[model samples]
Target: TLNKKLIEKSEELKQLSNDLSSANENLIIKDRQKDDFLDSVAHELRTPITAIRSAGEILADDDDIPLDIKREFLNNIITESDRLSEIINDILYLDKLQHGEIALNIHENNIIETYKKALSPILHLIQQKNIHISEVDLLNQYIFEYDEARMIQLFHNILGNALKFTDEQGTIQTKLSEKNDFLIIKVFNTGKNIPEEDLEMIFDKFYQSKNQNIIKPIGSGLGLAISKRLVEAHSGNIKAENSGLGVTFTITLPKKIINNNEVEQ
Candidate 1:
């Protein structure tokens, strides 16, 4: 009986040892993957940086550059630099969030006001696309206490997506409504539809839809994942669904009335 017990114990110990070994291997693999991602980010950032740097150097040396040419060159430099900075900062911010180092500056904000403010910069894109925004509830004032900047970032990410996918002159609609103590905002776009199989993995980090690859946009494919994290940080929810035309992204934010102890009632 003692011999049989010893055999059983030895088998259990071996199994436990194997499990630990497997876990350690997985950790090593994950570390390698992270390193690869960082390398890819660095490589991607360099392209825009190179363009901006070359333009700046030329502008610095060429005193005889035509005024119009100089202006165009300067604009390209600014645009490329801005694009590079955004991509670098986004990756760094995502890493910070993942490592629990991101801090939020929470404040009271009106959702509609915030939306309006954030959308101002992209008005040109909206107009150029001729995407008509159909409003559902403009009268509903959604005031919530949260990280204002992150909320803006989340909205920008989704709206940027709508702009990217929607075809020319397609309609994109924004709806804000209240439901059971939550303020919900939905952005619906008319364009290529997401495949059923792709929907499940769309929110995964670095997971761009196969359709997206066919029409690749200038993004790291981390926008939706980062937006999702930002929303969850505010105790909110975000989801994407096929809009019968293109795609619809819905964001639910838990809100409270200003200077009141009671939640939205």
Candidate 2:
């Protein structure tokens, strides 16, 4: 009996030690991720700042510069300044969100209306490209519980991205349905297929794909990251995959979210 007791105690202690080591490793990984995030932010900010400073210096140093050329430089400064502001704002917002400084107000509402509102900001751009937009017709309403504003933000990020990457005259579609006790929303776009390896990492902060079909680099590369966080805040899931001719983003949200201020998955 004494020998059995000793063996049991030793086993428990070994398990406890292993658990502590695993937890310590997680902390180290998190710290490393924080360092990487800061480095990426600085790297992204540098481009616009450099462009703005160079354009300003040229405009100031060259007095005989033609009025038209000066106007062009001024435009460049304005554009780069806007870009810098966007990067800073996204970083601040994401940091607060990840740290739980902000709360989500989850409630019941007409999800379809929220979806339409998400499209309003980018509708003109879609029209400009002559892209076809469609929604899967639902016989009954999808009155699901979610943070209305956050859902709009989530959809805007995915839809706007599809618009940005899709070819002119391409097609964009959205479908909403219920699976088990969850609501599933999918956004599909016609564009170049994303590399298979990048499907999952696209949600990581500051991650950019090795292959980009567009001539100019897309937005701060933070849109999908924000989308992922927003979905998770509602106890939801979001993922992307390369489809037949393009990529599709699928978001799954619980139909019933029990929330005080924050949700847990």
Candidate 3:
């Protein structure tokens, strides 16, 4: 009996030691990720800041520059300044999300309406691109519980990404359907397929795929990260898959995401 107890204790200690080692490894990984994020943020901000400063310096130091060329530099300054502001806003927003600083106002809403509402922000560009969006008829009667504002934002990121990579007159489609207890929303865009390795990292902060054959927009690259956080907040999952001739983002959400207080009601 004494030997058995001693062996048991020894096994427990070994397990504890393994757990500690695993945890230390995780901490090291987290530390490395923090350093990498800081570096990425600095580089993301510096590009725009440098352009703006250079344009400003040239405009300030030159009195005899051509009016047209001067106007071009001024436009460059404005564009870069806008890009800088976007990066900051996206970073702050992502931080709030990661820190659980944003609360979800979950409620019963029409999934169809929410998806359509998301397009309002980028409808002009979509129309200009002539991207065809199908499957609206399928979302007709599916009602689900979610945070409407956040859901709209989630859809916006997925759709905006689709638009960004899609060429003019390229196609975009949304396939909405029900399976078991979850509602799936898949946004498909016809364009260059994301590299296999990049498909997984597309949701990482400041990570953009190298293959952008159609368009090169000054994007903050935090949209998908924010979208992922928002989906997780609602107890859902979002994934990117290369399907057909383009890439598709599929989001699956449960039928209910009731708040604690609402649960009482």
Candidate 4:
């Protein structure tokens, strides 16, 4: 009689365990569905935005329109389109990165060359803001093996962040140096110091410093998170530090010097 009772209890416990497992699985599925919904919404909105921006540009090209008004309208349309495109690309790239499919095409590229290439598009803004840029004993000839596109994106994010946060006429400096066996890239910006508590989570997905006043515009808060992923993909490291009464981000990439001159220098 006791044996039969023990068997019945074991069966009941097993059924309960299975039910709990099923519940947990359902919750995971629901969470994934929510993420999917958000991604779909972003994609749908991007289509209409692209179409509208293109139409606006076409209209602006009409010679009948006043040149000044046409120019202003054209600029507004392009700016809005670029912003939307940036958001959509970030989301889609992040989604692929999560799925382990973002390809890295690493090559031996010159650091200064890469920096200059990435800065070309934003020179106007830097000039308008009166942000001063300098390097720290940086040699223009250092080369490191890395994914050019990904590193460019990383540079754009870090420098772009500085541009957004720093006030007009603030000084921003970038430095590249070789330390131990790694190549270090540092971007320093004078801005509101990030709270100590928030610093720990600044690289977390959807994490943004609450101390950053809504100046100009803010990104979707995924830039740092995506930057971290790209750095790690190259077996590199990245971190933030408070310096010069401001904020600085330090990135270290593992050095695979492709030239004899690299180690000699």
Q: What TM-score, computed on C-alpha atoms, does each candidate reach?
A: 0.77, 0.91, 0.90, 0.68
Question: Which lDDT tens digits does candidate 4 get at residues 1-265?
Answer: 9999999999999999999999999999989867865765565556658766676867756768777877777776776677667667877877776666776776888888888888888879999999888778566588778778888888988888888888888978998888887988899998877777777777765554566553434455578878887777777779998886689999998876332221110
Deviation from truth (RMSD, Å), model 2 = 2.2
Q: What lDDT does each candidate get?
A: 0.78, 0.87, 0.85, 0.76
Model 2 per-residue lDDT at 73: 98
Candidate 4 stretches with Cα past 4 Å from truth are: 1-78, 212-216, 257-265
lDDT per residue for candidate 1 within 1-265, as digits (tens), equals 9999999999999999999999999999999878867776767778888998899999999899999999999899888877777787777777776765676667788878888777878879989988887777867777768777777788888888889888888888889988898888899999887877877677766665566533756776678878887877776778888877678888887874232221111
TM-score of 4: 0.68
RMSD of each: 5.1, 2.2, 3.2, 7.3
Q: What tens-digit string does per-residue lDDT give for candidate 3 at 95-150?
A: 98887778788788998888889988899989998888766456368888888998
Please count the clashing residue pairs in each candidate, in the order shown.
0, 0, 0, 0
Report the lDDT of model 3 for residue 264. 19
Q: Can you tell me which runs of candidate 1 are displaced by over 4 Å?
A: 1-4, 7-11, 53-67, 107-109, 179-181, 195-214, 219-222, 255-265
What is candidate 1's CA lDDT for residue 150? 77
Give the TM-score (vs. native) of candidate 3: 0.90
Regarding lDDT, does 3 or 4 come out ahead?
3
Mind giving the per-residue lDDT tens digits that candidate 2 earns over 182-218?
A: 9989899998888888788888988877775533355
Worst 10 residues of 4 by lDDT: 256-265
Tell me, by TM-score, which candidate is best: 2
